[model samples]
Target: MKNYFLLLICMILLSCKKENKKNFDESIAAKLYNKAKVFRNSNVSDSAFIYYNLAKNAYLERKDSLGVGKSLVNMAILQHNKQDYYGSIETSLEANNFLRKIDDSTTRSTLASSFNNMGICSSYLYEFENSILFYNQALKYVNIPSNKYLYYNNLGDVLITLGKYPEAQKNLSIALQTKDSLKYATFINNMARAKYYENPNYNPLPEFYKALKIRQDNNDLQGQNSSYATLSIYFFDKDKIKALDYAKKMLEVAVKNNSKEDQLQALQKIINLDKENYLENFKKFQALNDSIQIARSKAKNQFAVVRYDVEKIQREKAEKEIEGLQKNFGIGILLIILIGGLFLYRKRKKRLEQEKELEVKNTQLKMSKKVHDVVANGIYQVMTKIENQEHFNKDEALDELEFVYEKSRDISYEKTDNQGEEKDFSEKISETVSSFKNDEVNTYLAGNDSGTWKHLSTKNKEEVYQIIRELLVNMKKHSKATIVSFRFERENDLIRIFYTDNGIGISGDVIYKNGLSSTVSRIETINGEIIFDTKIEKGLKITISFPAS
Candidate 1:
């Protein structure tokens, strides 16, 4: 009786385990689908596609037809967004096949969406009859008012393309009656387009303004710019001043949005409108248009390469599985041995040379920063002091010093000519600080010239000089500082420097530029650390420490 109980308990546990796993997989698939929808609504097309694929694969493993169908339709929409019309059609058909096999009332909406996407994709490819068929099928399954109106709009667009004006107008009129304000502008614009096609000489200015007002009020930048371009073209042959005004507005919108394609289109129209300067404007327009085309081509190629890499990874995984089953180990092993030897041989030689070159380049850049901070700021301050003088003497020694300092800035990879000379470390810091001090700010130094400066290396001294000089220059340019303090301390063989300024402190998001960046690198090169306390309101505080050399 104990043995029978044990067998029955094992069977029950096994069944429960499978049930739990199925529930887990179903939940994960549902979550992924929901997340994909969110991303889709936010216009994150690539991310939406990725999550949809993940959900589809999970649903396929669980044999969940409804989940798989929904994922496929979402992916199809993403493909449509990417302008992959054929791929969109294929994905939508696959989704429809899955949805059709499952006879569930809840799946009707998903089926409707899939068929609607198929219709849109087909229409984009100019397959009007196929588009109409898909639209009709979507209408049969669509239960919601919003989707029903969308189908009507899509059908109207295809009918307009097919030159069936009466049918297009009828469908568009029906779509306009739906109280969905989000789509109101688009429907209005489509009706205007149909009207334009119906009558060649019709002025669609009122219709264009009606759509533009809605789009602008909603802050729909792309829609607003599109309306500007349409109005510009509509007025191009009728009223030159109005055409130029709209074209200029379109250009402004396009530039603001960084839409190079629309900018190119607007520029072309502007050149046509401004006939007096046609040649000049046309040249500029052509150059920008060509550049935009090249950039777009490069982006398309990059996307293709990314897709190829993903496909390659999937192919390699399948190949690995096949090889594992076959146990085809000899060829791979031989190739690995040969490739490994060649790789190591090339890698060692190249890496050593590259490392040497990088080290030299870094040193040059560090020296450049030091020169810019120390010599450049000192000379600029002296020039400012001289310029602010009530009495001027051109023959003074200070003028010669200024000239020499200006000349020193031209060198390629060395600190200022006087930088390496042995001088009192604290005195040098004081001099650098005083250069940035004007009537607006008072500078003070403490413990800088004390015995703690004695244990520092020449390199350390130079780096310290550069770092302090950079801080002063930054304070002068940005800080609006009233008072500055410099404090030096020694603790356990660590030379610590503290700097503070009563300036408008940096915000949390300020990025360090070349001067501060190089200071950090220089300190790190000498095995030191620096920290900033910009969170302090209305003041900047910094602490830097390096071991005494």
Candidate 2:
């Protein structure tokens, strides 16, 4: 009884210790997260990103997926604000892996925020399609009316940029339902702009002025800058004088708000409009643009370095934990290595045997193909000539049979050298076509001279010879034609062969079977294209073209 009580006490102590560690880790994660929020609110983006990344690691250690997701979302937003758009997108995607796809409000809100940040980053990067997709995803997860309005506004703006005026107006109309005065102002301005884009004569100046007025009343300098920029663009072609005034106003608001990107934009408009001080404004634009690029590059590098440092620390901690187990597991690891080596050796031996078997099968297939081409096709050609001709020449038939016998013998020796056979390829093609001619079918050949076969390689000539033979055989069997013509021509670097027969055309789908399948494979091997045109109602036309080289 005493021993049982002692064991129970030990178990209780161990459980409490684990519980304490969990609480401790969770507290650290919460504190780090709160610190990040404080830094972000104070506009110290770098510090906020670092703390959020750290909080993410802490939450990961505690296996708190929600905390990790929230931290990553904040980090992604910080990256976005710093113009590290690609990095922001990557972080936002990582956050999505941790976030739950559930109806829980917090998870849904975080998921929406992550997607919304990705949309904004993609828009900045000029990936309008991806931006639209992300914004739609944000809308899917977002239940809050204000966020929905914001997403719709963003989607509408992107749609307008894409020249989708109707879609822009549709989304903007949805956004216009918002009671928030600032959001309403944004929606109306966008809606007006969409109308103007759809019809250039449509005046959006009144809505632009109204949005500017609301921004001014609310002390929203950023919003006012946007309004001024739009108005400047609206009057840019119509009235340079009015456009110059709006551009100057935009510059003033941008400078007051200390927004370098906005300042650069306003300077560009002013440089184009205010010609009197083009050089001065151009110089300012160049300097500010350079400074912004440099700052953004540094911020991107800083975020990367911070993330790397956190990961490095985590890796070092894991390595230390692993080090203590290595000595104890040394014998077991050695045994596993020995067993694994034997298994791999056996697997490799089996793989080699399988490869040998496959090679043998492939060789058999090649020999079978040689037999079909040299023996079977040769006899069929002879039979076709005997069937077509009234005065069958015994001497010519004997010579053809001897050639087939020799070719069949060469297949056993795997002799692929066809230089002798392909030397007179043009004559061979003429004879093959002539042999197919009979009382029912009239065969004619054009451009089948030796000069036409001069540029083709021996292998290519052989393949072409076989292809013509296969087509003639197929025509003899299937195409009960009265006339067949083969036209061969060389144009530039290409050799083209056109075969036409006034036969009942191949009906339905032309399944590549018999020797037709091998014909295609042979053509492909020579980088050739053979198109069998079965669309003709009365006859069949086959066009074959390939490179002369």
Candidate 3:
């Protein structure tokens, strides 16, 4: 009997756990979205916006991109209705990021709706060009004919505002083909306005009256306000009395519809046309305009607050979940940390030993480079002169040998030898290249002026000198050419050196070896590039370029 009681308790506990898991079921997001629709239909815009935002987050948590796009579209529409045009555009753009261009009808519809809302918001903000582009995009995604007509009408309206009357008429004509009577009225009214704007002599009153009659029959207060405003504007210059009467009718309709913006518009026209009550109408206009501004500001703030609150709740919920996970895995995490700590200690010890070995190797390489540059290359330059020049001065060669001796000695003491800095760098470069010239090789020099090396630093000059010397040495050893040319020029902030030799050009890849690697390294230290032209059939051409400073 006791065993049976324990089994019953276990079964009850399992059932409760299963019930709790149902709270996060995917259907919850759909329910929230439907609830938001109900609120929106009931005219509770703030509540609707909040619920749509919530639904978006729930869909995001489920990784449902399409659902998130749909929710954001509704949120944007709510913002648009609240006169938050900028915020509505931003939400619509974000919704577009989540929507895909697929064959799914629902996804395509949601995408189309998002773009259409953006177009409407852009129109409200007076960004007519951007509004046209967004409307065209909406048309591309709109599978339903009614939606296509709506986008076409919107595009035509903006095009008319931009004075593209012919284009506007084309789009409006397409929209007028729709079977929907209300849409036809909107399209025809827009087409008439386009024609009148294009040709001031065109009479749009007939079409305007027809649209007004249809809107009145349908009891569309918003459409009636549009028609009344249009009629008032049409009669304003022609007959002030008729314009005033129509403006008065517009104000009545706007007030009945509770649209502050339309009321403000009508009041402005009345103040302009009705001289008998100018001050009275002006006061009403100012008060209505102020109230509309305040309401729009408050709506923008409320939307921000709703989004902030939702994000805050989500963040706090995430933090709590993290905290619970941390608690649940506390011991496991502690053990992992202990193992990681031991592993890091061993790894750090090995890294330190490796770093020390690398430091020693780097020191050896530095000394080897100094020897090669100061001693070996110095001797090679002297040898080349001795072998090439008919009148090689013994005293000058001895002096060069003595300078190399001093530089070599300084390497052990780690002292810099500034002997190369005693002469103008251009003269030094000319003398160095000339030393490599003899009866066998004819060397030509151009653009090696003093101003070419004026802005070069002492270290950079040294690197350039060494690189030129290395190239000449490589030429002497490898290329059996007779003619060699060294051209130096300063173009803007860059110093370029072009070397050519009429010798057996390097075939295939120019292998970097036999001091050539060090030449490349020295060029890199001064932020320079060297290109060896192996494509030449008869001669070698090397170009070197580096910043002058």
Q: How far is candidate 2 from the true structure (C-alpha RMSD, Å)?
A: 25.1
Candidate 2 local lDDT, residue 396: 53
65-90 per-residue lDDT for model 3 (tens digits):
89899999999999999888888999
Give each model's clash number: 0, 0, 0
Q: Tens digit of lDDT per residue, candidate 2, span 1-549?
A: 134533432342233223477887778778879988998999988678877887898888888888999999999999888878889899999999999743588999899999999999988765678999999999999989899999999999988877778999999999999999988888899999999878878888889889989999999998999899888888876899999999999999899999988997788678667756744664575456546644654565567666755564555455445444555677777757755865686588668657755765566566556666766777678767766997775445544554564455344334553545434566567656765653235688899876677767777787887888778877876777867999999988889999999988875456475337878888899999988887787898889999986
Model 3 poorest 10 in a row by lDDT:
9-18
The full ranking of all candidates by TM-score, starting with the best, is: 3, 2, 1
lDDT-based ranking: 2, 3, 1
lDDT of model 3, residue 549: 87
lDDT of each: 0.69, 0.77, 0.76
lDDT of 2 at 316: 45
Residue 242 displacement (Å), model 3? 0.8
CA shift at 235, candidate 2, in angstroms?
A: 0.9
Candidate 2 collision pairs: none
Model 1 clash tally, residue pairs = 0
